[model samples]
Target chain A: MDRRSFLRTSAVVAAGIAAIAAGLAPLRDLKNFESVEEFLQKHYKELTPEEMKQALERISREVERQYGLRPHVRDLKPMDGVEFAYALNLTRCIGCRKCVHACVAENNQSRNPEIQYIRVLKMPNGTLDMEKGDHNYATESVPEKGFFYMPVQCHQCHNPPCVKVCPVEATWQESDGITVIDYDWCIGCRYCEAACPYWARRFNFTEPSIPRDQVNPNMAYLGNRPRHQGVMEKCHFCIQRTREGKYPACLEVCPTGARKFGNVLDPNSEISQILKNKRVFVLKEEVGTLPRFFYYFDV
Target chain B: MIKNYFRFLLRCARIALVGDWRYHLWLGWLAVICLLGLNAWCKQLVHGLIITGMSDQVSWGVYIANFTFLVGVAAAAVMLVIPVYVYKNKELHDLVIFGELLAVSAIIMCLLFVTVDLGRPDRFWHMIPVIGKFNFPGSMLSWDVIVLNGYLILNLHICGYLLYTQYQGRAPSKWFYIPFVFVGIVWAVSIHTVTAFLYVGLGGRPFWNSAIVGPRFLASAFTAGPALIILALQIIRRTTDYHVTDRALLTLRSIVQVSMLVNVFLLLNEVFKEFYTGDLHASSARYLFLGLHGHHALVPWIWTAIAFNLISMTLLLLPLSRSLRWLDLACVLAIVGIWIEKGMGLVVPGFVPTPLGELVEYTPTLNETLICLGIWAFGLMCYTIFLRMSVPILQGKLSKANETPGEINRVCPAIQSRTATST
Candidate 1:
């Protein structure tokens, strides 16, 4: 490498290390290379929470040292007592893009102008017709022309086709049912992106387009902040927020109260009540996505 | 000794790459410069996919299509390599080594495109440290990574070893040849199979979930990739002392012609499966072919692809066109035309209308398109350079192999006389 190139590479490494450190970067385990073979028998989930934390600390420090970037190594322990669930209303939805915008803002998504999660489709209510739906219409009025609104997000499927297609174990469903991605671990193969039935995942084609002032400071290393270009990302049920007992920003901001999110296993929860009283259906249920989002018809 | 070797190599390289190579070397250098410039553009960091015209509705764009196309380009080499290496078609076997070099370069392009398509190119390494957070088994993703990278390594090892022996003016050892042949066949088929699985394996996307997708990819790869090789070899023959004969070129075209026939058959088979079954999944196919869902944008392009392929095959199958330069040009056009047809026309439009029924069109950003062109140019550049470097080695081996048949005969009489006198 030329001196100029070397300096540039060093600067990049340093910036990366700095970003990682700020992100609560994981610790590196490079010192125990000799034990790699013996360690192969151990699965990461078997590690105690404390052990995982320590491992993350090493990962953070090592990323700092190697690339001069402080890569955030968030606590990999499944959110304590976390359960996966979602709900949707077919009758009330107007196909307005409120949920999509809410996801971007609440998730601190990049405004630097790239594809983000959350899409609103205006579907004609009576016909088995998709082509009749116009995504490009700028009138922005909804629930018109005998049309129904369907909001699509990560289905949090029990049998996610996206998870099954990842070449690198970059993204997978947590035991609690939330699909998580190792942002740093993904090789950007896009296999998972292509296989996703929901079009739920988004790749950062570039650094996020968010302005510095608009950047959400309370970012989780794994969940939000500045995503690098190329790796795939999708909704993680906002574990960074929800795990601490906060409602997802999208749910909190819903104008129509169309979205209901909670633990499916909780019988006493409002979602459970809604499920019992209403005829709820999933989108493309025949395809067996088992979407966490359920639709209820209003009489 | 190392100094002496370097000095000798300098002398050889000067002889090999200078004078007549001036134009090619300059062109290659231009490609290198373009690649460097593209790196700088990407280095600025894409903020999001919004840089490209891909909206939430149209998530995939040119990079993906290129990846799909390049997989065929990468796998194409094996289609050419296998018949020659395994079947012992002496005519095609002579160019097998060159085909392998092309395969290696194509894989590099494929990987590069996949890298540029991600959201976090930096975090890409996280997948490496075994059992990262979301390790899902029974995923086509796991298969894609394994086959693509595995085939790449397989080609590298096979090509590298063969090139080394050829450089020493000797045939690769017989032991290596048989395994190499098997790997070539399996790897060629696997490359396309894994790529097709990326699409067809999806459940929600009714258009992609078909059993016939993999075979279609393989058949088309064989047709388009080898046709390109034959054209490239002809170019080489004209510009340099690289001697591809009429008979060898004819044999290559024959392979190209036969594969194109299969390629068309696969297309028909796919159409039949969807149109005949009249299943719900058929809707997406209908949208693409007949523009049922108001995505009529791709109709003309798709039909043009079909027409070009048919006409190209007609020209190829006829002896008059086969021997004619104009027919060869038409074949080249058909090959490229199919590449675009399969890559964009077939691949992306299948999923354009999201399941919830919203249509978004994908228009590639300048950065994305430039990067695609740069990588493609780089692949071609790599192949050209490899040919420049390795062809001499291959020719030297051919010279020796050519003489060896007579050489044994010349030695046999002398040995026989000596044995008789001793008796």
Candidate 2:
């Protein structure tokens, strides 16, 4: 080779080496290495049954190690011919916000940054306008004289914009009508967060900080599992509980018994009954999300 | 043949590496900025996006805004390519290469902005088409991934091939690059349109849902991209031995003038619709232009952008201020105005008074700003290196004639004949 070409080759090689060194320098952090297994984990749907069992065990071990609770984290699959749906009674809701805290506690959400899935908006009595609803309403007593309460959470739409916007299929709508995110798989671009009309999704900006004492031992692969930093999380209709034929913690904890959950495929279920009997409406109905979550007032 | 191609690349690399002290100094400064950005990014990686000013309310802040703006810049390269290639405008033929180089750098910056914005950038492999489950065809973002990467590759191929031929002192084979150039012209429109689709397809963000968004993006991109080329070419002429024709600059100026006029007209059309209708959908625009309730943080910014755009348009349209100084100022104004209009005004305001009607103002933190500046510095560095290598080839200073006589005669017969006839 000529001197010019040799010199050029040397310079290019040096620069390439420097760039590779610089790029890989960040990965040298031991903490990054600690999550190597997590990093290589397959997509939730792509996991084999054997791989899934191992994943669940790993998740359980991680939660146990982190929270000092031996959580029974299971990969709950959707049942045949069952589509989940939810309804909330506006007239019965007292703006107590017990459901909000219950969701946080049950979901094993971060305590310090306070990632709560439920938002209870206190609306002025005379208007159905959501814009006028106040989320930070701090009063001595709820059900204040001229006010009504509306608690909004994930609507779990059949045609979910959140599912469609994810560049990676990290988030998707399960066949059971619940939207789920595989925390390990999500790149946390938050496109889904931006796309959700109800602002239902929450991102773990930092490693979620729940007190060891406050951790719920029961967890599910798609629901209340301990999530790492840099992933998206949202309400999955309390998949752990609901999949086991129990109510979501929000419904169980509501003082007014305002929340209802059931399989929509079962015509006799409470959600179907509410849809039939009540003047029900979904939030941002014009957005055409076709939300499984319904809201209604008593006659 | 392969060995010869490799040698050609090495020679090009040699040209890229060899530079004056001033060039080294500029590159050093850029490297320092990039290092600072990398340091800040390391901190962000450790601490997570909580370090950013972004919250769940305004989930996307400055990084996304910059990404959106740079996509426009990258797509704007096609404006030059269209006239030169399609219209057969010889005056702009030499200048189109510079535009393509700018595109390469801008796209690199666009990709960097996106990477830094990702909460789990390490998991980026998940977006790969086959191995990873890329939600393509259905997701606008997936479509974006495809188009942006595709456009980058197309421009790289075109620029690399042309520059290599020029370096060999050979006339480029039309059959090899003509089809790609035509594809690039259409692909340029697609890149920006897909970016616009990324915003407009969101049924949630009312401000971005307008049908006019895609056209508005093109109008602004066409104006801003060419204006940047004009400024860069002027700087190149002043600092280097490169000869950028005045006619080329004038043609670019006319493109900017026409595109800026259309851009402003489209902005007005959007304004009229939003303000006249006075509906709930108009609230985001109201928040942007006039501020909603008591929060008006973005009002002054958007108005200033409007003023800059108007003044720049005026300068470009009038024949009185056609001097170099005035033209440079107009180009600067257009670039900054379009940056703010497309970025802070467009992306942020869409999330302000968010879909749920909560007004949470977003402002980029110092870390965010540094990261942005670092990305810009990186793009500038890439553009500088590209121009440094390509300009010498275009000027015929680093041609095959400089090589051994045997090598030149064997490898570049077309180049020898072209050079011999021209000389």
Give every prediction's interface RMSD: 8.9, 2.9
Once model 1 is optimally superposed onto the true structure by TM-score, how far is the C-alpha of residue A209 displaced, in angstroms? 4.7
Against the unseen true structure, what C-alpha lDDT does each candidate score?
Answer: 0.68, 0.88
**lDDT tens per residue, model 1, B1-423:** 343233324433543443465665655465554555365334324344445656545666677788888889778887666677657777777677777777788888888777766654554554553544334347665566667888888887777667656654566787875686687678778878888887877887777777887888888888888887878778778766867777877877878888888888888888898899786667666766777645576777678888888888888777776674955775676776787777777666766666655555565667666667777777776776667666666667333233333333343555445545766
- Residue-by-residue lDDT tens digits, candidate 1, A39-157: 33223445577765665665555435433555554653455555757777877777777777878876767676545577666777775455566655567566687778766778888
Report the C-alpha lDDT of model 2 over A1-299, residue by residue, as the tens digit.
68998898799679857864674465455263335678889999899999999888888777777777788888888888889999999999999999989999999999979999998888988887667888798998878988889999999998899999999988998889999999989999999998999999999998789999999888888888888888999999999988888899999998889999898899998788889888999988889999999998896
List the lowest-lDDT window of 10 residues for candidate 1 chain B: B398-407
TM-score list, all predictions: 0.79, 0.94
